[model samples]
Target chain A: MAVNELGDHLRQGHPLPCGRLVEDVFDDLDRGRIDDHGRTCVHCATARRSLTTLMEATRALVDDPAEPPPNLLDRIMQAVRAEGRRGEALPLVPIDDTGAAVVPDLGPVDISRQAVAAVVRYAADTVDGVRARSCRVTVDDADVGALRIEMTLSLRYGAGPANELVETVRARIGSALHGQVGVRAGAVDLEIVDVWPEEGP
Target chain B: MTTPDLDHIGGHPGDGPGDDRLVTQIRVAEVAAAAARSTPGVAHLQQGLWGLVQQLGAEAWTRVTGRPRPDTAGTEVAVRVDPVTGAVTVTVDVMLVVDGRRPAAVVAGDVQRRIGGAVYAAFGVAPGRVSVHITDVAVPG
Candidate 1:
């Protein structure tokens, strides 16, 4: 039965050894398990190598104590507040022409496409090394209240790696919209419009 | 609950009796833009690349036709009025100079507050919505 299971595993990629077996092999808790897999299967060998690489990368990250940019916290807080204000101030336009229309006493809450765009633009601009050029925030007509935010940004040259900067902007905008504006960003699309030239030394 | 009287408040003077003059949407936008521009820490308003293109196009048209450009063509203010309630909403996009000292959020808030006040003062109706966008931060000299 064990041989048949191994054959099935090799053929169908079904039910490989339990995670415990992989952990045991890596931790050296069961040398016999490693020997069992090391002798015949190439899949286990590949898994072991991949796991080892992941562990090394995690350790390297843990060992690095590089401090975040000093303005990160301020930028994030400002962005949250700015975006929140935009969300709260969305205008309530009258949909119908009823003379006796009862304007809900919601006390000045407004929402519009431009308001959403402003919120997204402000949030993206708050990221260090990122300058938002234009932002277009659209609502999904089919799925009412769903938001799609698109932004064009000019990243500061030499501020940081481009990928890291983009990731930070994405994470910040998502979190700000969720936490501050009480809206789930369905899609956040970023375009690098330009790379700002660094000042002369 | 009592509804506030919207007509009794100040409005534009129309041609005939019982006809209330509606405030032009451009006027509302202009008020908001002036308010924002006057706020401290707001260095200057950015026309943006698109605005620049429009301006150049307008200039070319004017030069060829020898006609003055329309006032509404290049205005930065965008205003929308509710057809039923006559409520005005304004949106302004601006760039501020932070000088690395004050927070951008605070400057933006101040601008928003000032814009609301200006619109209210001009039209006697609270703006239904005021949206401010901070596009760029200028370094202080």
Candidate 2:
């Protein structure tokens, strides 16, 4: 079987009946019979590791007595409170300088109004045929963390290349968020927002 | 003596071939390209063209250098379920075939976005994440 196919099976977590397929693909890799192909097999390796860990956890759970561990509810509640505390205390901000604006130090500014503005400003300036009119960043606070940023840009074309400008803007914004804000900027919605030809009044 | 053509010596043929994640990934890429093309504003229709371009380049390089062709395109896609989170992660290799004039990153992002959308449509479960790898570029002959 192709390594890729084996990898697929592994990724799918489909059980391979014990044999060459299992022993060669999954077990051997676990046992360190990993060949060149085996070494390169990211899929098999990940699946094997995950499966092994799960199996170990399951075994530990089953080995325990019939009665559940005491203080289970307490432990659960404790975990929940701990998580809440963690969320409350955002960890992204390493240094809380009073002078600096604290835009939710939760590991990269969730694509917010500020983040969008920053991206638009950087992108529009770098690109030849573009300028920003207004930028709006939508913050969706739900089960999933991070806000949905929507930016509207007003563009004016310069004599230079058009594509480069857009490309530069996208790259700059993407890089800034990655480098400075440390948050994953969801979608850099470039509305064209509005386009003004250079010759226009 | 030449090999006999009567019947090939092999194990159970009925067992059939195993599934290939790379091929599946390529197929997924194709599906994605098709989906993007179907979408209102998409302008290109080269499904998995990047893979082919890379394949061509590797083949050319091998012939010119008289060296064995290193397998340049080895990628796989797998959909796995997380036992703990129950979320699904669809991991695949994405070949980006950019027109020489176009930016590579733009093509890469488009492929990634389109493929993500296609996967979501194919599988009921939305993938926790989609990772794309660009293998090659396609320039006209």
Candidate 3:
């Protein structure tokens, strides 16, 4: 029988390993042998083309060489050192466990403070004229998930009025924390440790 | 209905239907957390009040022991998976240092989109819901 005929037979009655076979055909580790049927079948041919495109895109990304910003490593290391100073073993708060019905072997659902800090840092870094030197976050043990945040910032002189800057920071922080983490920031304290001169206009 | 044979699927194990493979909640959370951190307008992730206490304690401990601080701390991630549909939901609380030039809402939306895309790419499962809580924002120098 022709390859197309064989593919038709597989589709009609024989099990042709739908998604799995397509994946195996592309995987480097286990490039499953595809008979002539796979080469001729329309569905498999389309899937193969897609997989090829994906692989090419991935290869291009791997080959790209992008330079990182100055002091990026130093800043990252500083953050790491700060975390070490803070210690490990982040606390995890449990969420609902009703998922046990669907997944018989489900584990506890919990969020960690370390994760929260990372998000805070990212949000703070985006503000203009504000460079986050360090951040300390606290979650209230109360029934309400209230947050107390303290950030040390290096500000640029003449970025904006100090009061305006503070207000903008407060609003952005409140919105980001609530939107991303589903937590409320009860209070945010910003300390300006240093002011740097601005660059060219 | 005929069950799909999962063993033939490539990539991670539990990614297929009816395969004894399992994706841990922590792993999913990490993916979400990484996505959030990568979003623009974010400064750093903060550990809440308890985190503050821990830092103070660490300071005291460092003063006494004179040992170097460890870099083990980062953002936290929490994941919830639906048993029926296998959908995942993620909630993240973050502190941002936004550009004084951009609107806060715009940055927040970007973070949300990035997190959703990252989760889908990593797990082949689109996040059912992604919630972001902004705790603080600052102007970057």
Candidate 4:
């Protein structure tokens, strides 16, 4: 405790890892001087290197930093925000008594809901004249691994969800889910939002 | 970045005397993250909906700057070390983006297996649960 107090006493605002203020280090760097402590401390060395890099970057930015492409700028910020949005966990195997799909020193596997949805979406996209919009693969409350897939899609402008077409899509989605994920889907509910006219003249 | 929460203070089912080897969350996460990142058909870690947007920009940057993007995988690992015995158990989570060349579900399974295998190989203990999330399906144009 006494040592901490002593270090704090010597510290400037917001001490670095070595109990020395980086601002002091910055000052020393500005004047092209490093004290005995700076010469010996690794943290100070790192800070000095960082300060040097920052100075270089600042000069570079001020000198020539120009406007980033508008589209690219928008995409970067969107990625920053959307990266954290993920779906719920869907167990790949049966959950035991503890509600964890594990075998005490063995295997326990789970995949995200979005992964299953992606499987459904990719499958739906394979159907002719169909564009998949979104999907949700929810676990059945009564069954361990059973899933119900709810999907939305837009049919081609001139096309319709004919009985034959719907059956084909259902079969395709079921096969994709079973083959890709190795789990049987309980129900595949396809809801066509509307007709898309992308291919129209 | 969520991992299984286990009581490490004491009385954990896995905790007992004579277990001396220590394993940390950081180490498991490192190993698991490496394995997941190396798997094929992973454009990068998950960034939901049209990850193609971000991938396009990143690819352009790499093309211009000649520096590959660093640290793409975000593996969440939680470790519980028994205070008394130093025994450890872990749970690892990873989210990835499918590059549209391979099936997402298959890739996800492979990720889970790889992380679980890598952690066990590194620490001689398996993760309690290895959760894989897929945020984007970047179908190639």
Candidate 5:
């Protein structure tokens, strides 16, 4: 019964979904120490999936340390120097107003499908153990436009790390697209294109 | 010294209007190529010879060394030295003449060991630090 409560929290995306019972259950499963309850209980299945996804995302955050594009330094330095000269200290320069001047209030130009795709690509690359070989985003013009993104990943072979890579990529990409791009990516379909050696030959 | 104009001083006089980034890229690329060529037996190293050489080692000169004869069973080792890291890795591009029967993986491993050993012997550097990139495989007919 206590395990069921934990399962409910996990399914509902509650923080601290794993309780003492769930922790013990996973420990037992890991060591092949669980005898019967784990197999029969629905709680164990839900808990495992939730915990695994959470752990995978956390692992990706830890493993992803690849430096950003080197040219970023040049761009940043240029922007900083440009800002220093334009001492107005305003974030954006307001255009000079005249009697006939018309201003348009752009309420976040409906985040384009392309923007979401870019965020997805960035997030997918950041996921540890997953290398994004290619990505494509398609927008179906329905009554309401729907965005679908497909990503091809090169799984790193020769480790259990690759097994977790899929979930990490999905979670990170989905979150990044939603949060940064402000677009609801309906589905993030993934294809494991090729398994490259963990250490390249 | 007289104060020079900001625009002129900021601009590198060494860089002419005709001077393309390609020239700098090419020079860096050639340093990479030279590093690879200095190694034992690289059949065909890639265009970014520097990155490959830095990741690999200078084993392309194996044919010149006359170590296992080219006519007989032998492997071509390619080395790329990373100018930034000063690290070198090696990959053996197997040839059909050497019984293309050899596995690229096996040859790659052997090449890796030899390149690492040679780099260590030559530069007094450790091999494990080097990153080896296996860019190509040559299978015999």
Candidate 6:
């Protein structure tokens, strides 16, 4: 019997509910022999069919080496990017009882660190003459929920006084994190990594 | 092949829920995932590296074998079932890409309620902990 299933839970090292590694079951399949549990267990039965199909497909690819789709490279690169896991999970800041956030029992709401940085970068970029380069965020264990942000920025050489621009960038980031994302920025450090010419390059 | 329990839904290995509970949890995740995706301000369910890999592998298998392609891709939710007690806990720990334009709190709050409501509606059981993870914010080009 074949199953129209891919059992994502049954990965390289994942075990079947029948309490056997898929590989062990695969071994039993290769030998054309399965123990009593494997013979009767539905999960094992599904795994057996799926593995047989996979093995056949693998052998086909190895033998024929079919051409990859043109977009396969792009797809692979996208998968390689740590897009979804840009950073550690940040608990969505708790809101006061009177605040708008729906507190309690929603479980743990976490925002990706990389996503927060994007918001920070966008916030800082809004400041005139300043461009956000990179942002790194860390949470202090003692402080908890409070974040320390270190931002690298590029400034226009003639963009007014550097100090004022830096202050504006810092304020924007803090506001964005607290107001938009509901997380407080404990410390925001900005560095003028490079200064660009005012004229268009 | 039969329809995927969910294009994106899968179970945890160690907890090893029974077949019945496993199917129920997959259904809960499907409902939760759909609700979250349809919620305003959500761009798409975030696909982590591992999730992407699983999806690619699943698709590749279908393509190479000329098997029917799954109607959907991988769903990123974890469901646990207590073996002895048979208590089910749904963890909708989704990685999502939110529209950068919206307020994160409002968007996230909306996601939580929608998923919870969906699961509760379908299974008559509220997901114990719905982890709404905003993995990335998509900035308008």
Identify the leading candidate in terms of DockQ. Answer: 6
RMSD in angstroms between candidate 4 and the native structure over all alpha carbons: 12.5
True contacts kept of 4: 0.16
What is every candidate's C-alpha DockQ against the true complex, given to 2 decimals?
0.01, 0.02, 0.03, 0.12, 0.01, 0.33
lDDT of 4 by residue, A1-201 (tens): 323433453462434435677688889999998789999875577677656755765565556555656686665554444343353556665233233433333344455576567778888888888878878888866656678888887787656545556677888888876655556778778887878775645
Indicate whether candidate 2 or candidate 6 has the larger DockQ: 6
User: Candidate 2's residue-wise lDDT over A1-201, tens digit each?
Assistant: 223433554465433211124334656745656666545444455445534644554465556454533664664443333222222221122122222333222112111233234444655565556665666544344413333445555567564555555666667666654443334455666656556777866
| TM-scores for chain A over all candidates | 0.43, 0.35, 0.47, 0.50, 0.41, 0.71
What is candidate 2's DockQ? 0.02
For model 3, state the Cα shift of residue A4 in Å. Answer: 59
Q: Output the lDDT of residue A9, model 2.
A: 42
Q: Model 6: per-residue lDDT, tens digit, A1-201? A: 001122443454555544567689888889999788987777677677667877998787678665767887776555444343534667774343244658565866777787788889999889989999988988855566678899899998898999999999888888887666777788888999999999976
Query: Which candidate's lDDT is highest?
Result: 6
Candidate order, lDDT descending: 6, 4, 1, 3, 2, 5
Worst 10 residues of 3 chain A by lDDT: A99-108
Q: What does candidate 1's lDDT look like per residue over A159-198, in tens digits?
A: 8999899888888777655433435566778889899888
lDDT of 3 at B22: 21
Q: For candidate 4, what is the total of clashing residue pairs?
A: 0
What local lDDT score does residue B132 receive in model 1, on the 0 to 100 scale? 46
Q: Which parts of model 4 have CA positions greater than 4 angstroms off?
A: A1-84, A87-89, A94-115, A131-136, A141-144, A152-161, A191-201, B1-27, B47-72, B99-106, B123-125
**Better-scoring candidate (DockQ), 1 or 2:** 2
B2-104 per-residue lDDT for model 5 (tens digits): 2211122112244443222112222322333334333433344332222222222222222222222112112223333353453444333221111112322
lDDT of 4 by residue, B1-141 (tens): 222223222122342321111123435666887888887766776433234343564455454445453333356566654545545567776766667565455566667777778877766777777776665556434
Off by over 4 Å in 2: A1-201, B1-75, B135-141
Interface RMSD (one decimal) of model 4: 11.9
TM-score of 4: 0.52
Best by TM-score: 6
lDDT by residue (A1-201, candidate 5, tens digit) is 323433553464311111225566556655766556555444455555544644554465456564544674664443333222222111111111221111221111122233334457778877666677787766634413335678898876764565577878888876664444333456778988888677866
